[model samples]
Target chain A: MVERTEKRHTEKMKKKQAAHDKIMAGKTAEKGLLIVHTGKGKGKTTAALGMVVRAIGHGKKVGVVQFVKGAMATGEKAVFDAFPGNIEFKPMGEGFTWDTQDRARDIAVARGAWDEVKRMIEDPSYDMVLADELNIVLRYDYLPLEEVLPVLTGRAPMKHVIVTGRNAPEALVAEADLVTEMTLVKHPFREQGVKAQPGIEY
Target chain B: MVERTEKRHTEKMKKKQAAHDKIMAGKTAEKGLLIVHTGKGKGKTTAALGMVVRAIGHGKKVGVVQFVKGAMATGEKAVFDAFPGNIEFKPMGEGFTWDTQDRARDIAVARGAWDEVKRMIEDPSYDMVLADELNIVLRYDYLPLEEVLPVLTGRAPMKHVIVTGRNAPEALVAEADLVTEMTLVKHPFREQGVKAQPGIEY
Candidate 1:
């Protein structure tokens, strides 16, 4: 029994060490500015969600904009809406950039949504703002990097924003307060050829 | 658009004010116990979970004895099994408390399982201990509170425990570091006159 206790405790200590390392990965993230999540990894949004739930538990108000995220239905969206009118979530209806079919309409939606998201960045009302899948928008040039940069830098005096997508731009990452390139460690999908699990993935 | 900005900022300030008030509620809970959970909250388990998660985020190793929880194949139990693994979840299957209806059999499971939970408290390995739904056992008199009190108070040097169930005793409340009474506030089954939703309610 004592040996069982010691083994798991050692594992626990190793995890604590990893968490500490992740914390120290970026110095500017301490003051909170921007988070850039990019790479061929599956969980940029999941990592952002871990942070969102942590902030909410700490009594923070959050605003979220999901570019190319509107399919009009998802279990997560349902759960997000169930949070008694405190948390705010808005999804740009263009859904996936590739799936939208009309490039011009997608760009128009992204541009229009950018105006609202840009304002939220500078407004002190949101404790955290998650611009989900915006990296893809930037990658495809649906929104200019010039327009994105100012909001990233001059965010609401209190608001912190996280940008998640694969293939995020180099300049954006260079400017980000915290940049985490999620490396593909080991994913169940790859091993088993299983599709994304709804609750776990989306 | 300008009005929207002002409104968002105003809401932010109000949320900050509400946050200040909620901060005190956590302090009220700090008589030295924490509970952390990372599973679906279909039943009474979610309330038990929020405390466990809050406790561990503050750096607590928690021990849990899940009497009726181990026998079933639930998504929550799988996730709990995957948690940092420092969380000791011994799922001794006795089925629902009333179903077994045998005092001798019930007492043996309680004795065997609570023995490990008690060991966690005495050895200083646990910061918070949750005997999830042990209150039901207490109500049935399968385990004597006298057998529990010494382990609870003597372990006061390093641990805090949460016992959750439907009909908690008045004496247990007095002994608890924090007691939360989850009154079934407008349950879905009663409201919709439908069966409990799978994974949302047991």
Candidate 2:
């Protein structure tokens, strides 16, 4: 009975491998991707930062502009600062929307951060640009979508850009080459009154 | 008009900050988290690796065991190798289930990796343990869920264990303190025939 099961499994895997190879063979195109991470869960920014780390590992230069989380100190800032030559990490926001509570100031801050993002995207030296929480500012209309979309879609062909936050606009999703929505399944803060900790949430 | 706006913003922020402080004050519990990153979209392992990087930044020791991606050379492996004192990165699987085609060998490989994970969990020196793609092995029954859950749930009070992959077991989900499901929004591989590139997928 075991011998028969082994034979069946081998045959099934052989067929599956053949199919996988065929699909892989057809994927020949290579270019920079316009990636978006949105939705109500965690890991959107964390995953984008992971890509930043990967780029750094490959000796590629990266630019990071945080749009909505500049009031507090983050562990990423301290870590990325260690690689001054490879990464230009900028946390440009004053705080969250509720904390700021000033529309004009929020718009000014978003514009400054967006301007930095535009510079990084335009510069050929940066291999990857992470617009951290850009979607949040966009969602709040602190920055105009009309101006932002053009610069993103018209970026250099070989430069990757990552935009992260919740409630990404439909138009941005339509334009992005890759998009992932993080759905919150369970949260300790909501259910068990646990606070966010260092080396985890930051 | 500008002065009025500023005045209103200041008052609103003051009230918001007080409320925020109260909420934070209630959250005094500090303990390790059982985090699960699962779903059909991208960034499951990527985000987990980001957390690993964060832990490293904080000078914490970490153990990473890859369960189903040993065949390919990954950028993360090369990167994590630079921090020998901090990260013990191990990719143990021969390949994916379809690539291996042997259930017995798969199970043995998974058991070996799980043993490593258990060791890391029990060791006091390790601050965080990442079971990368363990969910895939669990889904395939290469490792018994009954044996895995106890080691994970009963881990040390301050040791963080991160499990990443798609289709996490329902029981595992129930036990996780933080769970994020990466949902597929748009994929270039399916629509534009773009292959996974270095610094992005690996």
- What lDDT tens digits, residue by residue, belong to model 1 across residues A45-145? 65565455445544466777878777523534543443434467777756564444455676798887677678677777677888888888888787999
Model 1 residue pairs with clashes: A68-A95, A121-A156, B35-B51, B35-B52, B35-B53, B36-B52, B36-B53, B42-B200
DockQ, in order, for the candidates?
0.02, 0.64
Candidate 2: residue pairs that collide: none
Residue-by-residue lDDT tens digits, candidate 2, B1-202: 8799778877886788889978888887888999999999999988998898888877789999989878434567556766679888888888888998888898999999999999999999999999999999899888889999999999999889999999999999999999999999899998888898888987
Q: Per the 3 Å backbone cut-off, how many clashing residue pairs does candidate 1 have? A: 8
TM-score of chain B of 2: 0.92
lDDT of 2 by residue, A1-202 (tens): 9899889988998999999989988898999999999999999989998898888877789999999878434556555765678899888998887787777888999999999999999999999999999998998778999999999999999889999999999999999999999999998887778888877987
Give me the runs in candidate 1 sitting further than 4 Å from their true place: A1-30, A188-191, B1-202
Alpha carbon lDDT at B5, candidate 1: 57
Instruction: After superposing candidate 2 on the true structure, give the runs of residues whose Cα lies further than 4 Å from its correct spot.
Output: A71-74, B1-19, B71-74
